[model samples]
Target chain A: MKIIKNLALGVSFIMSTQLVSAASTGTTLETVSPEADRIALQNFYKKRFPNTELQDYVNGIYAVDADSRTQWEDIEAFPPYEFDVEEGERLFNIAFANGKGYADCFENGGIGIRQNFPYWNKEEGTVKTLEQEINECRESNGEKALKWGKGPIAQISAYMAWTSRGKVFDISIPDGDKKALAAYLDGKKFFYSKRGQLNLSCANCHVQGSNIRIRADLASPALGHTSHFPVFRSKWGELGTLHRRYKGCHQDSRSNPLDMQSETFRNLEFFQTYMSNGLVVNGPGSRK
Target chain B: MRKLTTSMCVTGLVALLATSPASALTVEESIAEGKAVYMGKSRGNCISCHQINDPDANLPGNQGPPMFAMAQRFPDKRILRAQVWDATKNNPISIMPPLGKHWILSEEDIDAVVEYIYQF
Candidate 1:
């Protein structure tokens, strides 16, 4: 591990030197590999919390703080999202006026398929998320679209997530596709770019300042951050989708929050979910 | 008529800008106000990532370096103020907010913060 760390550092140092020369000549910088980025990010958290297992990161803050873990475990004993899941199943099976349903829109009837989401759509030239697809499914089937963040959409998402428990995240950006790569790179840039009056980025809190407190709240590590979604937050007292959380985080930084399921956000989901490529599905989880 | 009025207003604004500092808070008052801003959760909240180095300080974080010997570390007060204004100018990856640059903290408040921290 130490040798790998040294090697990574050496490689980065060489790349940075090259980058400086490239900048001086007004040449474009080299494109980064998504796989390499994921490996490096996972290694970072592993080094940061030496005792933590990579898989344990799906638990978020609970993976580091024992007190929080205990509280989270007690809450998880009978998950708050149980009702939402049941409602989602009901909504999923119900036929639209056209006699088509969500199952008809997705492969394998949409069961246990949450792990394959935020995928690169070659024909559409866009990144597709399960939430966006759900709405698309509805609109195509002659039904009105559900709200993006909460309510029925969240419930259905929670149900799908519940079905996909333990399935590893397997997001993929199509090979040799420049547009897909561009989307991935854009998301990566946004993840690290500072914004808002606070002048903070997603990396600042989750990357550099994990486990640190901002007033009363502890910052969580970014690893496996996407594994859990459609979370039942005690603060909100209801279930909300991943985009909803992104919106809130942006607002907290005093940056203007992007619209739900927008291209920018869908691309961000692509980059973030790809980072947790090997983490198990553990969505519809509870959080404080 | 409009040009004369505009010039008069510009001159008046310049006079006010020049005299404002003289009429601002005194050294002791500035220091006190600076301390409040530094500690205020909605303001600087420097303690979120920095330790004040005071024994009585509460719940200081270890992300940034300890905040002792400010005068030694930053002999020139403007340099220190510039940091609080925007630390990223020195270190691009710095997590410190651009308080003045982003208008999160007014110039007057930043000056007060500089005065408060300079004592240590």
Candidate 2:
């Protein structure tokens, strides 16, 4: 029984010692129930910002940051992303030598299909993002894949997202599909799991830091944070895609950001977009 | 003779186990480890939130307070340790992560992080 005694001692030591939350393990995490998670997320933001409307979240931080709203409104009135949207439309309509275009590769002639993206592609057994689909469309039509970080990728996505304006995000995990559900949960854990030398998660800023000032900037709530993508940042003086922002945030937190369009990112977008369900799409946004 | 051999083997194992923790590292080694974690992208990533006086830290964050005169602010190591364990305990709304409580860093890593920060 010497082995048993040692095992007992180890168990006792663990019980006596400070035990950590088990949800953050990178591997072997059970798929969290998505409906419960979504309801809980909605409840959390509701409690955090009791004064804000459910629909107003499309405006992002402006829904909560009144002082910045006026400037945001002014920016929106003459949005910096307008030219990019126009350019994106022009690119979207362009065809290849095969006499086919982006429209031939998607449903409804590829119009108003933004909210349907970042979906679980069961055949691929991975989440598919709009950027990936865009490139896939290009390749299928015998055209070169557009670079992912910015420029053409951002431009085309901007046009697609613009067309989807006022279409509430409808991301879903197909019924009874456990792998899809597992990916969704993994995405949720990624959002909550702390990383970087600063040991922070996306929730650390967006979820917990909402209405809290960090060097004069008000953090947005995580509930509808992903509604806007292919946003225009005045700081960069150009448009950037969602993955670009993901990389920027990870680096800012001192974590090694997964490569753009990596599995983790595709899953991350799936989770974030699913959380943003029912929030109106208002992309090609202008941000400070 | 068999019993004696078993006892001797057990004694040797016990001795090795007893000395392992004590001989784990010198302060200099711990400091080096702390520096690596503080600067490395995959580890503590301290530069993401706190700006330190170290020359190696580039593009330091302004989100949190500068990591300056830390040992003076909380002379007791426990005070600093408590903050690292869970800053939320002190302020419920604190944006800082509980490096220890969340399993982000193990106990020894937290100790190293504290030691490294104290140097700032």
Candidate 3:
């Protein structure tokens, strides 16, 4: 009788533990209903961060009001917006070393370009960001690519961001596309990967429990950052593209910034932007 | 009759000149002076990080905020002046050097630049 009681208790404990773990990891669309999927995500975040606040959207984008929140009015007056767009336009029209202009590369004349960014490429088995696509176009055309985070490419990107002002971020992860799933998973891995001199991951500054300080300013969450690209930086005296801001963050972390149009950066952008899918685009924003 | 017309024309010119305030410079003159200051020739050389010019100029930098639509953003001249003079006091991480604290400009120079920015 005693042995049977002990065995029953052990089995019950094991079952409860398994249930908790499954709840935290969430389920793929194939395995769970939409409502269940949302519950799973909520459970996962709640389990991982018991104290942090959580918000959800249908588009998968999440805005985590970071520590320091700057009003839109305050940012609108930043000085960088003064010249970034003009400079960007100049670079866009200029011929690259291979004699191709930025306008010649895109499908829609780059008008709705931001909408399709951070896409999954099945052929390459990877994610491609706007920056990577731009650089790749330059390389394929036999032109010397601009150094990442520097020069004409960055300027053009800033211009693209400026043009995308007020547009809604519309990215979707289609069902049953294994490549897209893998790409998103890769993005998630990148988000949690810790690197740089500070040993920080993207999650460190964006997620709860990580305290970010710049002099005295509070750090806003990374969730909504993608929606406010081509930001006018008061320090830069012009508008800056998303990748340019990424480079800045990299530099701040004491890590060498990737090229402005590099594959890694594109993947990061894809992940970052997808995370901000539902937020309204507000480009040419000002930042400190 | 011709003499009378000439006199009327002169009177009109004088009235036009007299009606305009001496302190209120035209937008073109203010932008020109601001450009000079931005290029580092005037009392305040703001070009170190700021790229100030129309799109035709093509010079770009990433160190300071753009100057477009300043009037719409900060309608109050006093708030704008305080921000220019001491941004760090408002937001500590602000990289902008305090022009007022550094004595980079006399009070008159600061006032002129502030006025010019307001006009923008």
Candidate 4:
């Protein structure tokens, strides 16, 4: 079956230098069934690594590589992001210039709601991510917006994600709205489309080549990729938002990174987060 | 006489352009250069995704097919060159970087790597 998929991909590659749609593999996002896409993706991983529990994917590459898992376990024993989460909680409570706070901007006082983010805002006609909303919340409260990728923004998000740990993602798209579907499809196209001088799509590494070594590191699976964010990577020696990691991957592929919370990126978050619907949230995670 | 000279000049230019970078090196040097590019983490990094018959290859990956029997697998060296240049041309899902297409490796580097891999 892998051989067949490769052949189909080869044929599509011949058809165009860019925009090689998933149509060749019959997993095309042309259909309006996001549920089907989610199911198919889940099944793909289940078959690929039969021993991997669905919940385990939140660990990213650690789920597939036992040696890495051992190291990760040791790190988790004394989680480095504890200080970041504490700082975030402190910031979350501080009053804005208007005497209101971030709690005033969100339901449930903005706690334990990380999984439902990157949702379709029918009135706004865009996907709003947790990071974007955090900035928006600050701006609406007359506070200066935090930077999108790292620093305080990532710290705040880390606290929120920590509160929502073990809650499975439950993202949804409005069935009647063409705009919502269009946004999802746009993200789907972005995932499969080849870009940059490297001619790599997101799927080339994360989806098809998951668990594969690239030099010293492993290409993580797309499944549950959105679950863990606000990662405390040893490489950075600091916490950062999902968009920051996304930017790094783009740069590695020799492509220019898009602005954080850009429409394209939000849509991608929507698609990826929704695909991880049944997976548990496990963010503020540390990694090597 | 002028026409003959012009044709000869065109042929000479074509020959110069067609001459591969490897042609300038002794066989040993070309293979050594290719091996460096293949093993370098920042260069071809082929060993990151592929296994090779070479016992000296340190911790090669199994993500891609092993790089042995290349002389048999790709009978035409040009096909091997194209594959290295951009494996996606043959398999879009292939995670192999388009080393030449992306300018990740110079033409000279690719030519050398191709000569080295062709022997496998």
Runs in model 4 deviating more than 4 A are A1-30, B1-22, B53-56
| Model 1 lDDT, full chain set | 0.81
Q: Which regions in candidate 1 have their CA more than 4 angstroms from the true location?
A: A1-30, B1-23, B53-62
Residues B2-114, candidate 4, lDDT per residue (tens digit)?
56655654554465457744468876889999999889887888898777777679988756777777766654455567778877777666667789888899988998888
Give the least accurate 10-residue stretch of model 3 chain A, judged by summed lDDT: A6-15
Off by over 4 Å in 2: A1-31, B1-94, B97-120
User: Candidate 3 vs candidate 4: which has greater lDDT?
Assistant: 4
lDDT for position B83 in model 4:
79
Candidate 1, A163-182: lDDT as tens digits:
99999998987778888988
Q: Top model by TM-score, which number?
A: 4
Which residue runs does candidate 3 get wrong by more than 4 Å? A1-23, A26-72, A95-100, A209-215, A235-241, A247-264, B1-120
Better model by DockQ, 2 or 3?
2
**Rank by TM-score (best first):** 4, 1, 2, 3
Give the per-residue lDDT digits (tens) of candidate 4, residues A176-229. Answer: 788998888888778877788777789878877788776567888899888989
Docking class of 1: incorrect
Docking quality band of candidate 3, CAPRI definitions: incorrect
- For model 1 the TM-score comes to 0.83
Worst 10 contiguous positions by lDDT, candidate 2 chain A: A7-16
Cα error, residue A103 of model 2, in Å, equals: 0.6
Provide chain B's TM-score, model 4. Answer: 0.79
TM-score for chain A, prediction 4: 0.90
Give TM per candidate.
Answer: 0.83, 0.70, 0.51, 0.86
**Model 3, position A113: C-alpha lDDT score:** 69
Ranking by lDDT: 4, 1, 2, 3
